[model samples]
Target: MVFLVCLIFCFLAPALEAQVAVRDTVLTVRPGDSLLAIAHRLLRYSTEYTAGELVDRIKRENGLQGDAIQMGQLLDVSLSYAELLDQPVIRGTNFAARGIYITAALAGSRRMLTLADALVAAGGNTVVFDVKDRYGNLGYASSVPLALEIGAGQRAPIAQPAKMLDALHRRNIHVVARLTCFYDARLARQRPDFVPFSREGPGLWSERGKSNWVDPSLPQVQEYLLAIVREVAELGVDEIQLDYVRFPTEGNLADAVFAFDPAVVPKDRIITDFVTEVERVLEPMGVLLSADIFGVAAWGREADRRTIGQHLPDLLPHLDAVSPMLYPSHFEDGFERIDRPVDYPYYFLLQGCQRLQKLATEHDVLVRPWIQSFDYRVTDFDSLYVTEQLHGAEDGGARGWLLWNPASLYEIGFAAIKGFTDSTAATVPVKLRFPKSLGMDLTRPTSVAD
Candidate 1:
């Protein structure tokens, strides 16, 4: 009987070893903690397991078919070497990559070479091509009938949008689709009844006599933008960035009017409602949704409340990342102790970024600032000045930064920034210049030194 029992125990031991044991562990879901974060922490303890492998184990044990771990939810985690080895491999974040913006015409033509040359000159590792511009036009051919009816679809300079994405992906270059929302002039024009007009009549919404925007309070407008976003997601792009998400700023406010329906809701609820709806439709699609807010929004102080109705807390929950347009040239007087706003670019940029970073941490969102890369007010483009802005963003605890040169010219500015090598066959390594105190534990939340 003893020999038989030993034989049974030996056979069962192998099976038991393959199975994971559940154990309770205390974990504080820090700001920015996601389902991926929890898996990453567990894999750190189990040397043989990676985050992806541990995620599979956690899902199997928890009876989860999808990734949706909530903040502060205590999870039971365990893993085995054999199970881990069978799991999928995870990719590392490309920290040094910078994003570039390209227009539909440029992306489609052999002028793509010019754009590529510009990217190479600027040390850019990512390209954000416009799938839909402010006109609400699709850069590529669309199957959506509304897109055809409204004349919103186009066969871009690039024969196929998917081919462009695939080429970028092959180069290990991250591609983001820029979908301009709310300020869609084309849609508003076609459907004048849906346009936000002055109290006078059914006319177009104009800002500064240069651009026109759609009414945010309109449900039909929201649906149109969502359809474009869905089309971009299906293009196999890495991320979809929503530009002009807010109301038009520099316009005739007193003369301007809203076609906003009083029956549907209140004015305060309009912006938040639109953002929430967009997130709800986009989140489960396995793509990231990012929104651009004014630099002042990051201050958490309602400075431009009337024009740019963006409040930090309101927009935080609806986004994967928040990019504040911290262009120093745009600020008014008395910012960063500079009597002349444009003269002190570095100082204002640093201070503004710091404020924005603080707001991002409080709301548990990632900060990726749009820094000034072009010389607007200044007669000469300063390379060292650009480096200072980069330092400022890094000092303020930005995860990554992007340079904005409207014409795609960035030779001087890129040369000045540290850690970027020139576009040549034999390149020299340049040390990345980051503030020592601004150390980012890629696996953990950001913290400012006390």
Candidate 2:
């Protein structure tokens, strides 16, 4: 009899453990259902409860920690909701196979919709929005006094940052905040000492003729950017993508000079210091940090490092991900050998990403290359080229990619990718594939990048 009981107990344990106490329910609150009303309705059959008692019970039931409900949030009021009230809710980070950028202004203004609407238009799932722009302007009003002082505070055309985040979180869309670092014209003019200046002259700026850029060497510069990163962190952004992380590259090198005091620091040290400081601030917060490096840097040559101050091995340690700007037009002659660099987008993009993949593998860092979505000097930017580049990035072993169109307009390129069918709904998954002919590794690295 004792042996029979033990066998029964063993058989029942697995089934009990497998059973989830709460069913996966998506409750849509009707227009008339108040917090109290819903509770009374769900508990009407219970003999001991009054309607008034049911209302309070319902508030407790739905794990409505606060007495509030939005118009149409599909609440997951399962048995777990009550137990998980104080804990940080974990949401999915599944991004769409193809994603696009939406300016904060556009996202807020006429294009504004329930977080659902915006996701559907871009083929759904992932959103890359501007938290801070090239001009150092914040998309939403900020609590930081320095942000407001520099005119960084502006209402995101979308109006509600928290509400938007909650909506997107519910839909499982990965939200990435694009923060433009070092390219602040407004702050540069306001704080001239923080800007990079030419060593040739007391007042000369770099050749890009852009008079703005925070001196990367300044400790205060890193502090200022960290302040912004922290503010966005509180909003629950999945990732913080640092743009313009490099020194000014297009300017006349002969005339243009770095203002960072050489007696105090070395050039390579300055770049790494800024990245390390940013990582130091962000690491404790548990946020993913990524930096954009010029495509040429992946080649691991001295000239590339001199031009952009970006050394792959040096930067790999400080970043969770590195995005190389592999836009074909940005390459020089003999890249893919199609005569005009613009004419041969696929060749340069594929080769550039392949080289970057190899370099990143050596360093053991994640590579997510930025692909060209717009036509530069050439006029033929169709679906075929866009798909080809996407395939190339995947083939080169990149985890994912970002499409670049300075104007924020994306249509033909988005349509070209396969697997996704819904273009009018809020969130949907799209499938993508890398051709078998091209070899790349998708596995996580066993060792960290140097």
TM-score, each model?
A: 0.68, 0.68
Model 1 TM: 0.68
lDDT of all the models against the reference?
Answer: 0.62, 0.61
Candidate 2: stretches off by over 4 Å? 1-98, 110-124, 154-158, 204-208, 257-264, 333-338, 362-364, 419-450
* Span of ten consecutive residues with least summed lDDT in model 1: 81-90
lDDT string, candidate 1, 1-450, tens digits:
432343334333343323543333334455677656766554434422234556676677678888876766655544322112221112233244366667777676545545565565556666777788887777887777677778887544444454455445545566777888877777777767666666555555566763357778777777877777777776676677888877776667655677655336544367777778777777777666677778766555544654566766667777777777888778776543345556555554555567666656776667777878888776555776676667667667776777777776656655754343332322212222222222442212223321
Question: Tens-digit lDDT track for model 2 on 321-354?
Answer: 7887888777765542334565554544555567
Which residue pairs show backbone clashes in model 1? 108-157, 108-158
